[model samples]
Target: MSIAISTALQSSFADAVTRTREALAGQGFGVLTEIDMKATLKAKLDQDMENYLILGACNPPLAHRAVDIDRQIGLLLPCNVVVRTDPDDDTRVLVEAMNPQLLVQVTGDPALQEVADEVTAKLRAAIQALGPTSG
Candidate 1:
């Protein structure tokens, strides 16, 4: 199965990040943490790159359900959503999220399928709400 669900937005990187957060929030997911990859790389290694950010998003109810089924699931909790400019085309911004189904697939646990399915749907909706996407 595909590992990520993503969309391309015709907006500046900063605008895309804001819209991505709003879209995820509309789907009942909240940003629990954020990492500014561009700044980190520049500061630590004096490297330069396109704007990039990772938002740790979580739906508390869904997260709680998954953890109840498998304590180790926290390792994958707060699904990561990345907002970055396309390296090949700086004019385009990409918003991508981890496919929630991976949790069930990796664990090989049928019980977690239900929660994964729910999260997958919500994540899909969040990506769709952003704008047009390509497979």
Candidate 2:
């Protein structure tokens, strides 16, 4: 089962980044953190690397309920979305979510899986929307 869904865009990195932000915001998530992997590597390791940005997005109400059911589940909240170049030399943006089903195993809370699946769908939709600027 694929936990992530991705689409390659013909547009430049900046355009894709802008669309990614908009798509996520439309789905009730706000970017809590943005890590520029390329810039971080160059600054710390002195290596020029391809552009990679990590968007840590979160939806508040769902998270509050999920954590109330199981405190340790916070480790998985605010799912990760990665936008970067793949190894094949093709620039691709990837959004990976914590599998909704897996939450049931870890915490034994089926209610949380429902919430996770909803976010997963939105994340996939956002990735799809970034694919050509068309709808």
Which pairs of residues collide in candidate 2? none
Per residue, candidate 1 scores C-alpha lDDT tens digits across 100-127 of 9999999999999999999999999999
In candidate 2, what are the lDDT values of residues 5-81, reduced to their tens digit?
A: 56666556787788778888887878898899999999999988777888888878777877887888888766677
**Deviation from truth (RMSD, Å), model 1:** 0.8
Return the TM-score for each candidate structure: 0.97, 0.81
- Candidates in order have lDDT scores of 0.93, 0.71
Among the numbered candidates, top lDDT falls to 1
Candidate 1 stretches with Cα past 4 Å from truth are none
| Residue 75 lDDT in candidate 2 | 83
Shift in Å, residue 116, candidate 2: 1.3
Question: Which residue pairs come into collision in candidate 1?
Answer: none
